[model samples]
Target: MATHSSVAHANLTVRQTLLHQLFGDHHGWLFERLRARLGCPSDAADMASETFVQVVALDDPHSIREPRALLTTIAKRLMYASWRRRDLERAYLDALANEPEQFAPSAEQQVMAVEALIEIDRLLDGLSSRARAAFLYSQLDGMTYADIARELGVSAPRVHQYVVQGLRACFEART
Candidate 1:
């Protein structure tokens, strides 16, 4: 029993030793070829190391018929990884470009723009039914609210209400 155990242990050790030798002997050759194909030395070396690590971890290491072909496949996978990284980088850069600048507008311009918007809202709110309808029709539909009331046969107030309710609902939904 001791002899059998000892022989099995020795065989396992030999197999590990053989794998290590094979890895070291082909490491540089594979890396160089990968580097030439990939156009990057550091990337090639990293990928080659990863490929050998994968090869040794497989259940049937000896079943691989062509080491060179296996290495090439690994290289292709690494190239795909590189492309994915680059694509993510491009998307990030594009998003960064569209980000708002971290600065306030000129105080006078900011105040003026806000004041104009407030006045416009106030004017819309203060209009009489027919007047407001006319205003909205002229502003939104390029028609006089008189025309809208004439078409709908309702008071201009009703038309203004419809526009206000629609606008209010849209704003509320957004919020």
Candidate 2:
């Protein structure tokens, strides 16, 4: 019987071989497709590489019947995530720009803030737009339920429900 180490090595070898084949076959096509959409060669290269990295993490890379389609799906997700992160950073910077310089956070604090925002965004990803808005308004702005309801054009009770949903999402994300 194969030793456990040897079995693990075999699995690793299989994953590497599968990744090599997929990369060799799809990297160029994926790069060009991303480049055309993004209008940047470097970004396309990075996205393509990230797409392959996602594929490598799959439990059954050999089971893929539509390689290009899978690659496209993965790359699109990576692109969207990259865009979201950029948007978050831009919004954070815009908010910071409005603050007094004396009260400004350090560069490291800014980075940590952005990262926390991203985490919160991810935690709230399952929420509806209105629900997310309600949660942010309550948590970040300390808005009352009635005020959130007015802002969201919903009843105060409905706003309460949204806040509850958002809280559940955050709780679920933690576990």
TM-score of each: 0.49, 0.92
Off by over 4 Å in 2: 1-12
| Predictions: Cα RMSD each | 20.3, 1.7
- Residues 21-129 of candidate 1 have per-residue lDDT tens digits of 7787788889999889888898888889888887788776666677778877876876776665565456544654576756444557555645553444444554455
The CA lDDT at 3 in model 1 is 95
lDDT of 2 by residue, 1-175 (tens): 8999999999889878878888898899999999999999999988988888888888889899999999999998888988999999999999999999999999999999999999999899888999999999999999999999999899999999999999999888789
Give the C-alpha miss distance for residue 100 in model 1, angstroms: 1.9
True-vs-predicted CA distance for residue 104, candidate 2, Å = 0.9
lDDT of 2: 0.92
